[model samples]
Target chain A: MNDLRTKLMEAARSHSPSDAVPIGFEKQVMAQVLALKSTRQPGLLRAPVDAWALWTRTFLRATWSGLGVVMILSLGSLAVPPSDGDDSDYQGLMVDSIAMPIDETGGEIL
Target chain B: MSLLPEPSAVPSDLELVHAVRSGETERFEELICRYQARLFVMARRYARREDEVEDIVQEILLKAYTRLETWRGDAPFEHWLMRLGTRICYDFLRQHQRSREITSTELSGDEVDWMECQALPDGRADGKADAARTLVARVLDRLSPASRLVITLLELEDKSVKEVAALTGWSVPVIKVRAFRARLEMKRLIERLDREKYL
Candidate 1:
């Protein structure tokens, strides 16, 4: 019984193409792989070209820009004149003296 | 990305994947060369057109390489590839079966009869093992994707049920039941073949 089946299997496998790789299959796949390799990301997350470097440089540029603004504000404040316009309402009252009549003296309290 | 690492230094698929992740492209190719035949055979059995088989094999290889990061390395890489190819083929077959029209008679008569009885043993005259394998491959080809895979992994590849489940993303109980049904189906198919003149 077993002999019968074995013969059949041998016949089947003999005709079967077990390892018939197509001509240039490796080259074709490798070509695609080369293209694939070019598309690979540089990190775990695919960062765009100059993403991090550009961001850091922009940040530093903005920081200096902010410092310039601060310096300009300080210099502008220093260049302004001090307060010169004073109120004169209380100036005349500062020296005004009130005299009580001398008690029964000094020309009869005139 | 890192350059492809040395093959001799990599001990496992996981290590190879890590190396690829680190930017070693050759490691990926190493993987492809090693398993391409297996995947191609499995895919060919499913695809009707030779072109379709080649496309599916390339597609699977590309997908496998691209998604190697997703591989958990918990199961054998070959089993994982088998699972991928089987699923793809199943989807393809199911789609074609729905859309295509074929005469029942043609389906049965187009192929020549398989003379399973004539196969002789080279050294071991007891042909039990080899005969059984031929019978099994035929039966396997007829089975549903889920059912066929259980036997392919557990019987042919010597994977445990747990390993099969892990590779297939199926539960152990599901794998076991499918395996049982697949075995029954194989027996029935063999008996039917026996009735035909091929045996």
Candidate 2:
């Protein structure tokens, strides 16, 4: 194992492949450097936004996201339905607000 | 000797960097011209294709330009540039390693014979430096990115542990540990290759 390791190291050190920078590489870099900040935005916002196109794209993207949320919530609700089953307090509040008749004095009926 | 007064002194890398930061962006081009070749050589070790090498060099230069403000003058500019270049190459290795699939079929005839010779205790594979290099390269490619980076620096580049640590921003013990694991990985890869070839 040591011998193989030594041999591999010797072989790697012996392999000296030299590469010359491609022609115009410096110019290419300089060109990019000069345009770096300007190119970042890509002029996307400069173009006029068609209201219909904007809505269509928004609707398409939102469709999948909305569907995903709905599916997750549906599955979650099914997995853990309200199993405590103690709703008397909640039912009383609803009945009082919807069914009770109040006098002008606002006192409870005797 | 007709000595013309020495040609205009070449601007130091720091001077150019200062000029660049002072809004003389054109001076950055000189830095590019000075270091691009060295950067390409370093990048070529990680990337085999010419286009990939070019992209790596371009990224290093662009990154250096943008991050010039972060460089304190405590270290030489070349050292700083090389450290940055090393990190970029390692990143490139990791990103590309995912897509690089190696197989026994890719081994050349020379590489196979070379490996076979090494399998024997007394056998010697002389005059096959190219084959040895190919085999080593294949083994290196199969290694994880961290292992590949460590082995390349510690073995192929003949860097000391401290130097490797400095280049990679890793601690000395980390470098030592990685070097040990890298060697083990290489051994395993070579053994596997040998097995698969015969099987």
Candidate 3:
């Protein structure tokens, strides 16, 4: 197996494609480069070229999400009971706050 | 007066790259003319069809052009370009791996004879190098993409493990491991071919 492997490697080393580069290959590559240059932004300028597009996309997404959150909050607020002009609720809250326990150090006990 | 023209100093690859980056795009052709033949030779090893080789070369060149900025000047430009070329060739191998099947019908009579010649006592097959090459290519086809890449680099290209690791971005130990498995895979492929031929 080792000998066969050596022979195979020898053959591979000896074998190379005799064909040269196809004629006009350089022209084809040059043409491609030229076309690419026309479309592709230079490295220095690419970031700026994409900046506006990226900003527009980000801004639009943020606007939609903000509106969505607002809509959800508005709908949620509608589900909650509205408070009447009554001092009773405030009076009960004030009593609860006064009745809460406090330690000597002024930290609330858990 | 002698008819011979004066020898002019050619621009270096780094200089040409700088020129292209500085908006002198035409200078890129100098780089292409300098390296295209070498790239074609490398691509030919991975792809048999001339058209496929051409496409691979084109892709490599275009990629080099687009990513030219990423090439730090610490290394030689040829090394950078060849590394890119090797990676593209590996990708081409993987992309075409599914379509490149090694069937019995693919081998020619000479290739079969070459395979049989291996079992002989002397194991000499003169004037059948092409057949050996074909057989090797077939066996390589049977290997997985990573195996094929490792074998091609280690054996066919005569690259050292360190060099292969550098070109492939694989660590030295990984290249060593892959090369060992690749050789084993090649041996199994050749044995299978011989068995099928006998049966």
Task: Sort every candidate by lDDT, greatest first.
Answer: 3, 2, 1
Error of 2 at B164 (Å): 1.1
> Which one is best on DockQ?
3
* Candidate 1 vs candidate 2, DockQ winner: 2
Q: What value does the lDDT take at residue B130 in candidate 2? A: 87
Give residue A15's error in model 2 in angstroms: 1.5
User: Per-residue CA lDDT of candidate 1, range B90-184, in tens?
Assistant: 66655544312222232222122233323334333343444444444454556666655566566555679887776678888888899888767
CAPRI band for model 3: acceptable
What TM-score does model 2 score on chain A?
Answer: 0.33
CAPRI tier of model 2: acceptable
For candidate 1 chain B, the 10 contiguous residues with the lowest summed lDDT are B99-108
Per-residue lDDT of model 2, residues B1-199, tens digit only? 7322233489877778767776778888899988888898899888888989999999999988777776777899999999999999999988888534566788998988887888798868887888998788777778889999999888888899999988999999998888898888777777677778797
The candidate scoring highest on TM-score is 3
Q: lDDT by residue for model 3 over B40-157, one digit each (tens)? A: 9999988988889999999999999888877868899999999999999999998988543455557899998987898899888997998998888777777888999999988888
TM-score of every model versus the real structure = 0.49, 0.72, 0.75
lDDT of each: 0.61, 0.82, 0.85
- lDDT-better candidate, 2 vs 3: 3
CAPRI tier of model 1: incorrect
* Candidate 3 local Cα displacement, residue A83, angstroms: 26
